[model samples]
Structure formats: structure tokens, C-alpha cells
Target chain A: MEAQGVDVVVLCGENNVAYATGHAAPSQEPARAGATRTVAILTRTDVRLLTPPPLDFDDGVRELAAAIGDHAGTLAIDEYPSMLVHAALAPHAPVDARPLLTAAKFVKMPAELDAMRRAQRINEQAMDDVLPALRPGIRDTDLSALFFRRIFELGATGNTVDPIWNVLPTSLADGPFTFTGHLPFPLPAVGRVLEKGDVIFNDAGIDFNGWASDFGRTWYVGVDPDARQRSQFRRYLEIVEACRAIIKPGASAWDVAIAAREANGGQPPWFPHLYVAHGIGTDSAELPFCGTDLGAEIESQVIFEPGTVLVLEPVVWDDGHGGYRAEEVIVVTDGGCELLTDYPHAPYE
Target chain B: MSKERVLDEMGRREVDVLILGREGNARAVSGAHRLFLAGERAFSPGCVVVAETGAVHVLSVTDFGVPADAHLYPPSWNPATLVGRVAALPGVRSAKRVGVDGITPLFEALLTAAVPDASLVDGEAIMRAARRIKSPDEVDHLRAAAAVARSTMAVALNGVARGLDDSGVVALAMEAMAAEGTTTAAFEPRISRAGQRVTVAVGVLRDGWEADVTRTAPEVDRPAELVAAIARCHPGVAVADVGADVHGVGCGYEALPADERLEPGMVLSVSVAGAGDTVLVTEDAPEVL
Candidate 1:
């Protein structure tokens, strides 16, 4: 943005807030009561931290003041406003801070890459315990509850997102009868049960040390999957692997996306249109979005440098059938890209 | 059982011999029992405990990392060298590699690796039936959360003004909540600008509307008459209809025409406009909690 002659940049989005300040209320849950909301003002040589009133008047402000003092200037602020108001006021700073930082975070730093890898390891462990617990009579909500309980017990704060529980039914009507259907439901109920031959899909993430690792896995309940279903699973895994294979330094996000599409028989999943890939860090979604029209190449000639973290997911869906997609976290490096998630992409038995 | 009876039933199902595993079953039962078990390490992916009578044997893959002694584990030599060890003490049995779902192919793998002869039982019915009603402690926490939300609204109303936008109101409310030590707002509050005047017909309109139309009759000197006029207006009447009838009346001309009904528990923002000036009235004078 500085090269483009833009002087100031203000960030108000939840993810942007996390990038600016270490403190961010989890997107999946409400903020703990009395936690301080923060706004950071970044200039060429100085950084100022602004906090909301009452919270700032208390000990939180003093702690923030001390933390920010090492950066440059004394913290200066107006009244701490809502996230929206803060975004509006963000650009008023002397220099644009968002574009600069966003470009920098496109590749993962070594520490961030390590965090993602650790998070994925924990996720795999949780899956090891969770997949077997799924049974014919288990309710979708009950399964989610178990996932939450186990993940938290394993030392994770919580799941990165609301665990998506989809139960394959004998017919489309039977499938849509679930509580949440498709409209993104919140909370869980105990009465919805799993039936025989149900193909259960769990699309969830794990938060380790404030970093997130998300992936999706499918399970066949009560009976073994059929030949066609098995083949579909293989194709899904192949698509994800194809994307990972070509994802290296000097590659474009579009190229990675296209590789996954081509591997899936030229018909990519709905996920590509929904969200192909994005940078991930403290906040779940970061910068450097991968889509058809992004135009930006992934080479060194581009602004994004090494040490940036990214999530690559290619989705495939059929209108009459259902949805299948696989996701993995990767870090841009000097040599190529490093895969953070090491779990096998095949369906859990 | 009725929805309220679920927790009681679960409490009754707790066994004296508890097994700590690395899975949800152990966590749920432990949380339900509130008993701290000592010494039992998470043996493998699955943990098991058998009661003295052997009537109830709980199998789970979730690990809580409780002590080894609180719950018994399988005994094995060279605990240090064991990649995955199964220990069976005097009264307890532990499994090293149990799958999460006891019915899947992985479950078979877990059973073969640990106790292949263990019987499969359905526990979902028992567990789901237990978490329905909110316990007293849960209720208390929810009430506390609601109070925080209400107080946050109070702060927003106090800070609202004509020039202030929606974002300003939201900030003020959040700031108040933060000051009060509440971490976040339960929901976003609604704020919008007041509209211009309109007309209303009698009979079709409510008593509050008639009272509003006639508000000019009451004055500071005539307290009784003002009270009488107020009495004529029903507490449940809609604020908009009332404002419409009194649009040209003394202070009524300045009233912002609002369409919301006055409910007993409602937190209202009562405003009146006159001579290009505005006045706001709130019940109990909303304050930052």
C-alpha cells in the first residue's frame, strides 16, 4: 500500500483485530466477560495501543501501556469504540499499517509453522479418539458434545469452529430433517441419533497456542462403505494431494486450485467457489485469498514473502449427492512450502 | 423420564469403581459424579474401569489425565519401556488402544490391540438422557450473563444522542460492559433515527393516543390533572399511536413517533420534540451497571 501511495489503513474485522493485537475473542465463542477490547495505531516508526474506557481505566490499560511502551511512542487513544467504529477510525493514522502487515503474514514464520503443525498433531489425536466413538445410535449433537469434551480435555481451548456433523440418510428428505439442515446452526441437541449405513462427516479444527489447524474427515457408521463411495473417497484424497504436490515457492494460488480441480475429473467441489484457500494464524482466516480472479501470482515477484501461513482446501459437491472437501495448512518457505498437517487424507475406518 | 429428571437418573447410575479413559464417556460421567479420581493415567486411546460387583464397566477413549490411584489401571512391568501398556490392578482393568466408536473397523482394531473379548454396550441413551436440564449452578451462571447484558444496554441508552450513529451506541455499550468487568455483549442493540409526524383517528386508536392528544391540558401547577391524564392512558398502549394523536398538543408535538408497545419489562427510550429541541425520558433512569 505504501508503494501504491496509500498513506493510512484501518483494520476493523475480527481477524484484522487479532493481527494488530494479540487479544482476540474467539469467533466460535463469546468473549469472557470483562476482557479488554484493543485497537493499535501503527505508524512508520511508532505503535500506539488504544483501549476501551472503564477497561482501560482499570488494570488492563496499564498492562497494555507497559507492553506497547517498548515499541516507540506513548500510547494515545480516544474512547475505545465498538469493532466497527474502531475500523472507521483506523485509517486516520499517519501511515498504512494493514496492507504492509498483511503482505508480510502471507507466508508463515517458523514459529507459526511449528504452531500449526502442533495443532494438527493434536487434531489427529482427537480424531483417533472421536472416530471410533461414532456409532449407529449416536446423535449428531451428542457427537459434537463429545468432540468438545475430548478436545478440551486434550489441552485445547476449544474446537476452531462449530464441528459440522452431517449424517447420510436413505434419502435427501431424511438427510435434511436434521436440526441445523444446511443453514449454519449454533449449539447442540442430544436427541438426534445416528442410524445404520450413515456416513458421518466431521469438519472441524483445533486451536493450539492461539493458532488453528482445520480439516475434515468422513466416517462410515454401522456398515462398510460401498465401492462407489470408496472410489469417491479416493478421488477426494487425490484432489487434496494434487494441490499439495504443486504448492511450492514461485507457484500461484490459482495453479494450486486448478491442480485440485483437474485431479477431481475437471469438476471441482463447491468449496472452490465457497473458499479455496486463505492465510491462517491467530485468527482463523488471514490474507492472500486463493480464488479464480485473485490475479496475484504466488512467486517471489509478488509482495507476499516467506514465513506466511496459508490453508488450502478444495471442495467438490454434486447437487443431488452431497459435499466432500479436504483442507490442510501450509507455510511458505525459501525452498518451497511445508505441510503443517500430517494426518492421512483418507476416510477414517 | 421427564426432561428435568435426566440429571438425577445419571447421578444414580454412577458406580463405585470408576475407570478413567482418554474419551467423552469418562469426562461426562466424571463431570456428572463430580468425584475426583486419583493415580489413573490415560492408558491408551481407550481407558476402562470395572466396579467391584462387575455390574457396570465403563469404556472410553477420551483422556482426562486424572491421577492413577483415583481409578485403577492394568498392572504391567517396565512401564517406562511400554509404547502402549494395558494394566489390570486388583479391581480395575485398563485398555491401551480402544477406538472411539466401538462399532467401527477401528473399534475392532482397538479391541484386538487391547481386550478383544470385552462386551459392547450402548451408553448413548444413558448419556443423552442425562444432560437435558440446567443444574442450579448452570442457572446461576446464565442469570449472571443476562444481568451483564441488561446493564450493557443501560450504558448504551445513556450515551445515545441525535448525532451519534449505530457504531457510537455500540461502542458506548461495550465500553460500559468492559468497565463493569463483563467481557462481551450478548447481542447487538438496535438504534435508529426518529421519524416525522403522522395522523391517527379516535376509537380506532387506543386510550394512550387520546391521552397524548390531550397532554397540553396537564401542567406542573396541576399535578393532579396530569396524573389523571396519565391514568387515562393504558400502560400497554403503543407509543406511536399515542404520539400521533398528540402531534400538535403542547409537549406532544415534540414526541418522537415510535411504534413499539410498552411492555412491563421493556427498557424504553421515551423522547419528545418541541420548538426544535428534544427531551428524553427513561424509566428508573438507565445507568451503567
Candidate 2:
């Protein structure tokens, strides 16, 4: 904000407000909600958060405008509460600061990184605990619930993103894969029962104290070695290698994405494209998203910088079988990228 | 909805076309009428334009196959792109006054530049009034959603043990809801082991309707005064003035203002609005739908 010459920033988005003030505004729970504009205004000298009674929201908002007087300069805001924020800061426009804040938060502080590491421990524990229980007849949602509950047990404040269960049928045949979207939705367990020899290829981002840990593993349901299974799993390792090879401080977001796709023998992505790499800190999905058009990024070409915590999720797939996506969180360092979460993809390594 | 009623309201406000983009308003309007507008599921600042003749044209993200009759932008399209798309829709070009539910600052700029001649008025109150009462089908969806939640809580609580942590209990509850055919749980369930305090919120999406409810632990019941104050909220009374504890529970988990009144069959999530121990507005007392 200081670099952008933003005189006073009024944090309206819940996540941004939480990031700025360490105070989470009253959320509507799984929805962008709150009646009164309990906003945080950051001036050159002081910071103010005016929370109004739900009844006196209009009057409270009127006061918000008065607080943001004169030095309107460049106010940054998120899109959800853009209407109310705009109404309150009328005349003084709020540029969408999501991109700005997202970029700024890319370099985690030592304490922030420590918190992220602690968050990954739950995911590590869940991966270890759930595998032994994996077998035929387990519903996808149940498995999701089991893992998610494990994370909660590990002390996750709340999950910014939901646990994804893209469990495939035993037969590796042509069909729609149940991969979760980029949106932070925790898909309640669905009733699709797993069959013998089925592969549970899942990905999830757990919000541990607002820090997201993205990691997942692929497992064969109560089965032994098979040529087809081994070959499919090999492709995932290749993509991971491709991402790691170029994930240095100076790497380009687009180059890493193209590399991962090409690593799968030049196959077009199932969803047109995949965000092979994304920064996660305050919000589950943050800036420096590689492999896709990062709209409104301050930088024309997003160069990787040291301290950038990236979730390198390179998905590799084969024909007639479901895609194998392994999300390994990494931090870009002065020399190379460090693996933050190394939850294994295969039984071997 | 009575198209004539909406058209009448639009005429009174001198609005040729009422453009609604806010999710809450869009869902409320769509729930009232069975015609689900794809634009309602769109990005903020996107819209469903209700024409003066009662025809609805939508502009939303492309992932959702917007009806062949409506407009669709790429899933990656932002609000500014949507504002332009909404203005170019068939009816909007000819319309004189366009009423919008709400506008972001960036959106306000993009809109003013795009439709210099058009008069844009905030039409939230008008649309709210139009879609105030829940239709029978909407009521059915809400009922199914509520029923699914009740059964889910039953199954979850059945599996709970003294040693189960917050996450484990939540998992059991979610597993039950998932088994019962629920896809969305409007909000994350709140669980704490100290007093076994749990606020299990279930918002199920069935037949394109989202019915929401929250269930707290049996031990921690809400104050009787708070519950009574919430019950007093009716179609004309502002809910906020009733009491500081008053909250909206069903559909969207938002807090209503002093002016936003509760209508009959509006599934509210006021501390387990549709859950056990909740009352439905009646001449006598509460009854399950």
C-alpha cells in the first residue's frame, strides 16, 4: 500500500481485515456477510475500525464516509462488499486491492511460516491416519469428513478451503473426474462408494489459523502392484520434477505452468488450464498464480521472489484414467525451493 | 412472481429495466420465481436484467451453461467485463432507467462510462418487497433442506462420544449430512469440547434451493427472551430493533437491518431457526412444515 501511494486503505474484505488488524470481522459463515460496515481505515498516522450495531448500519456507514475524508488518494478494497464499501467511501473510490494485498502477503514472515508449518502437521497426521482405514465401500464424503475432522483435531481454526475427494472407481475408464474447483468450497461428502482397486486421488487446503496448507496423496484401495497403476503414478512424479526444476526465485508463473503441462507428454489440460502454482498465506488462494492469466496483477510478468510460499500442484494424467494431482507446498529461497509439505504421493517415495 | 406487480413497481420508480447482481437478491428473486437465472450465480457486479415487460436476460460466468437465451462470459471474466455485457443486452440498450441492486466503486465507474444517458437507481428495496414472501416451491426446497439437516444432526449426534474432538464430531455430522444427500452446509459447524458446545449449521442445496439451519449443543439453549423477540419479527417489523440477539438463520445467513422484515416461510437461521426447538410463525405456535 505504501509503495502504491495508497494514502489510507479501508480494509473491508474479511480476510484482508483479518490480515491487516489480526481481528477477524464477524463473518456470515461460508458466505460474504455482515450488515454493518465494520471497516479498518489505515491512515499515515493512525488506524481505525468502526463497528456499528447491526440496526444502526446506515448511520454507522454514514460515519465511515466522514472518517475517510479528503485524503481519498488510492483506497484498495475487495469485490464482495464492494457495494457497501463504495456506498460508505463514496466520492473516494476503492480500487480492488485483492491483487495488491495478495502480492504483498506472498513473502511470509518467520512467524507466519512457523504457523504454516504447524498447520501442515495436521494434514501430515490425517494422511497417515486415513490411509490404513482406506478400503472398499468407503463413501467419498465420509472419507472427506474423516480427513477434515482429523485436521480440526490438529487445531485448524477453520478450513478456508474444503477437503476434496476425487476418488475414482476401480476401473480406470473414461468418465468425469470429481476434482474440486479453485473456489474455497468444502464439498460435503458425496455418496459415491469406493470400489476395490480404486484410486483415491485427492487434494485439499486446510486453513490453520488463516494460513493454508495445500497437500494431498493418491492411494490405491486395498490393492497390489500393477503396470497400469505404476505407469499412471510415474506421470505425476514427472510433473512434480518439472515444477521443481524451474521453481527458483526468478521463475515465471507462466513458464512453470507450461512446463508442467508439457511434462505430461504435451497433453492439453482437462480444464483448459490449471493453476500449477499459487501463493497461500492469509487467504487460501493468493497471488502469483502460475499457469493461468492472473488478472490485475501489479506486475506485468510475475517473477518469483524469495520467501514466496507456493503450492506446486502439477496434475499429471493418462487416457481412460482419472488425473493424479499432488499438491506439495514449497517456499522459494535464495538458492532453491524448499518443500514445506512433503506428504508422499506414492507408497514408495 | 406476479410479473405485473414487478412491472408495476418498476413503472412507479421510472425504471425501464431492473438489473440485479448481488447474490442474496438474485437468489431471493430466483427462489420466488421458479426461473433460475444463471447470472444469479455469477461474479459480484455481474447481473440478471429484469426488463420492463417482465422478460429476464442474464449475464454470468461461462462455466455455468447460461441458458441459450441468456448471455455468458468466461469464468475468468471480472466485474468490469460484466458491467459492459449487462449494458449491451437487448432490452438494456433501449431502456431509459436501469435500477441496480448495488454497485461497486469500480463498477459504478464502468457503468457510468458505458451508459452515460441511462439513469441508475438503487432498486434493492423494490426487489426485496417483490420477493418478500416465499413461494410454495421455494418453501418445499427449504423444507427438504431443513429435513435433511435435522436427520443429519440426528445421525451425527448418534456417533458422538465424550472423547471426540471438534473436528471428529464435525466429521461425523458432515458424514451424516453427506449420506443424507446434502452438498452444501451453508456455514462451517462450530464445535468446542469444553461444554460440548456445538453450533451445527446445515445449508443443503437441493433442486437449486439452499435451506439453512444451525443447531447448538443440547446443553446450551438460547435465552427465552431472545427467542421470543425473534418470533415477534414479522413482514413489516424491522428485525434488528427486536433485540441485539436477533439473527436471520435460513436461506442466506445474513443479519437483517431495522427495515428488513421477516415474512412467513422465510427459513431464518436465528440460532437454529429451522432446527429443533424452533417455532414457525402461526396464529397459535410453531409447526414443522
Question: Which number leads on DockQ?
Answer: 2
Model 2 chain A weakest 10-residue run by lDDT: A178-187
TM-score of each: 0.47, 0.79
Which pairs, if any, clash in model 2?
A141-A189, A162-A186, B249-B268, B249-B269, B249-B270, B250-B267, B250-B268, B250-B269
- Cα error, residue B111 of model 2, in Å, equals 4.8
lDDT of 1 at A197: 76
What is the lDDT for A157 in model 2?
61
Docking category of candidate 2: acceptable
Fnat values, one per model, are: 0.00, 0.18
CA-lDDT, candidates in order: 0.41, 0.57
